[model samples]
Target: MKEKKRILLSLFRKKSNMFLLGILFFLLFFMLVSVSIYNTSRDTISAIERTYGTSFSIGLTPDKNDMNQWEDRAIEGMDSPVRTYIGPNVDEAMVRRITEEVEGITDYEAGSRADVMLYEYELVPGYHAWSYNYFTTHEHHLPYDPEETKNMMYITYTYHTRNSCHFDQFYNGAFRLTQGRHITPDDAFKCIISENFAKRNHLKLGDTLKIDLHSLNVRAKYPIESLGSVETEIVGFFELTYQQTVTQYTEEIDILENWVITDNEAGRALDEIIGRPYYLSASQFFVENPAELDEVMEQVRQLDWIDWKYYELVKDDGLYSQAVKPLRTLKIIMAVCLVVIVTSGVLLLMLVILHSMKRRKREAGILMSLGITGKEIRKQFLGEHLALGLTAFFFALIVSLAVTPGIGNQIYGAVNKGGEQKVYTEKEIEAAIARGENSKVAEMSRNQRTGVEPPKELTTRVEVKTALLVFAMMLLIVYYSVNEAIKKTLKLEPIRVLSMIE
Candidate 1:
């Protein structure tokens, strides 16, 4: 056994054989590393998609007709007919029906808004930048309440949802919770007031906020005249970052300072006061699997119970699609690269084995003539290639740890040259807000650029399982090539092999 092993080891001592081994080592190394990177990149992209890629929204799809599209009514003193787009209304029942029936929907946010008059507490004055200046320059009278002591009106937002983090103001960095926590679905009649408003009202966490429901305004058509008041416990305080507005309207109620966020029960109580049905102003849904978002949406559409006429299912996946466009392209490129590398590597390896076998044809014939079985001769060739392959595998794994990150990032950077929209993390947004960089956050939100940036650099490493998989595949190909080459060479008779070699 030792003598045979010595002969096998002696093959490596020859300069020519060493050169062949060197070539084989390099080929297998690149092949294994390439495979590892491809897999790692796939996993990274999937994680990004899962974290930031899936979002859906349910919105009103108003009737599209000449009469319903616009209400062309002339005011007694107006010069022209003012056209207004009257959208359809959404109800609590509809929100529940859609959410309950949608299979892939993992979570949703639903909320209502009501404008109310404050009788006891004074509201923080609304800051007007453009509108106030424009009215003053144009000598137009501002729309101030005739009675300064009269109750001030403000809008209150109410929510009952699994995740309140999806709120536009909170999500876009326009508002940050300064004290306490957000309103979750489990909460009932809890409130989150702005810091300025809380200070103005002399309120703190755990204080009760009493709002008069009778003072609710319905587009000035009529006052709510609701006979009751709803009181909510203030659980949170949020700081409203300064905002830059291009277009402005008159009214403190239009600003974020006067806005109050509360639970669904509080909102429902307001509706109950007026003896009116519960309605939802906004509802957002999310899916479990972003990759199958389209399929989930299709399932929602197929539900015959849903009247597509009154409702529209709007997908926020546009940004998701844009964000993942390059990722998807990178995935395809990786797949193609894997195919090309594997196919070429296998073919090249087969040729190398064949050439090496041809060189040792005389040796193989001599061994067979010495009563050595073809199986034993084939095993010797297998052992030689296996040794080289194993060495290359380990070396490739070690070196790949250093190179994969760079190569993976380069591939990602190349495909994402144009760059996707940048979405900030909660911490980054809060930091920007703290620095009074509200305009930056608002601009990002306004442009509908909600797609999160792909990973700055793809983190890739050759995992042990991945390395073993590639090594196993390499060994299989090497074994097949070596066995085939040996079979062809060993078929020749010992005399025939010697004669041909001579």
Candidate 2:
């Protein structure tokens, strides 16, 4: 311990030398570590922004509210094939045209439904269709108030759909399969019922329910296209996690309650018996990436098969943008700053260390003349810089901890106009929504597919991995500087270093 102190004191006998070295090492290490922290934090912030900020949805929506947008743009003279049939539902041939014409779609699922009565007193509701209880209370259920709707018959049909769908009515809280398994798109005869409806009807899995398609048309004096009772096999029942409430002016009847879900073939069988060749209430089309939704929507609109009268593209971009905008701005600014800091820090550190090389070599020679072994002298020189470098590293770490988050937030805040991001701003995108010319709105961004938002603030921290990396880098640099000086001292005689006094 005593010898170590003597060697250290000998090296720093001149207070001026010690003061200068301390300042130099502190400044260099601080710059290096601080810049490293900036770069690391910037990358972390960028990843968070992209992963959560790119959320959005693009699909063939049944937004009847938006129909006016396209209806106004319809050019009667133009030659086009797509068309609508009953309100929101599109033609089967039109859907086939879309499958063959459009590009940039990742996956798709189309679905349709019908209304039917399970018993004389009951008009069972499925999807968004009204049940006997709700319609019975409304005066308009009969165009003229019927004396009593208790015995009235209504139309209800089984539903059929494709797979991997993000159907708004079904994806809300999502349903749990309470009995049996899911109905695949291939099944033509199997069906699944709501747990509540199953319990109410005293029906269990494997039970066969007969749905009549011609009863309503026959009673209304309209020609029944086909007449017969179709028996559907109940394969499963699902319990609702959350049922979606329909928006006003929406013609959709499927809202997840008492809604029977089946595959397309079975649904078509029911539709054919009721006279329509094909009807798709709505179909959702997924894009490969949410970030490219606007581009994809535009390409879809320009296709020859698209006729706005029947189908419109639907977007849910507003749902998540307001949640992630601020963090996105922060990530952008921090990334730029990180680049500047790292580039400047490396050059400055190299120049300063090379300039001090001669002085370090002189110190090594003097220590060797004092009966000190080569290893001990080397250890002493390395120890001195380690202490100074580590102290500066800690100071840099503290500054990074104190400044990174505030700096990122401040940069983002300034760009966002004093921390108050406005309500979602609309951008004129390249593509038109089925509503014809529609502006894309930017909200607090979120992950569109997962519907999850990112952390509120820019994430910054001196992680253990980062700290160790900085320490290892500084140690390596210090060792290189010391080793170069020692090489020169070993080549020179010890007596030659003592002759500097003369």
Candidate achieving the largest lDDT: 1
Q: Which residue runs of candidate 1 sit more than 4 Å off their true CA positions?
A: 1-7, 48-89, 99-107, 112-163, 166-178, 185-234, 238-281, 285-303, 309-326, 409-449
lDDT of candidate 2 over 1-502, digit per residue (tens): 4557854674566344455355545554444444444554456545544443232322344555755434422323334433342344465555555656667675566777666544421323431233344565665535433323332333444567775134443442256677787766567677787777677678888988666564443344332223655567888887755433332211122334445677777667776775766667656556666567678777777886455655567665443454446555554554565455545544454455545545555665667776777778677766766666677677766776666556655554465553432222122222223335432311111101223233434445556676687668667766776676466566667777656533
Q: What does candidate 1's lDDT look like per residue over 86-139, in tens digits?
A: 545676566667779978888777887776654456665432334434444675
User: Residue 306, candidate 1: how far off, in angstroms?
Assistant: 2.4
Q: What local lDDT does model 2 show for residue 194?
A: 75
Q: Evaluate all candidate structures by whole-model CA lDDT and list the values in order.
A: 0.67, 0.54
lDDT of 1: 0.67
For model 2, the superposed segments whose C-alpha errors exceed 4 Å read 1-108, 113-143, 146-159, 164-173, 210-230, 242-255, 284-502
Best candidate, TM-score: 1
- lDDT, candidate 2, residue 198? 74
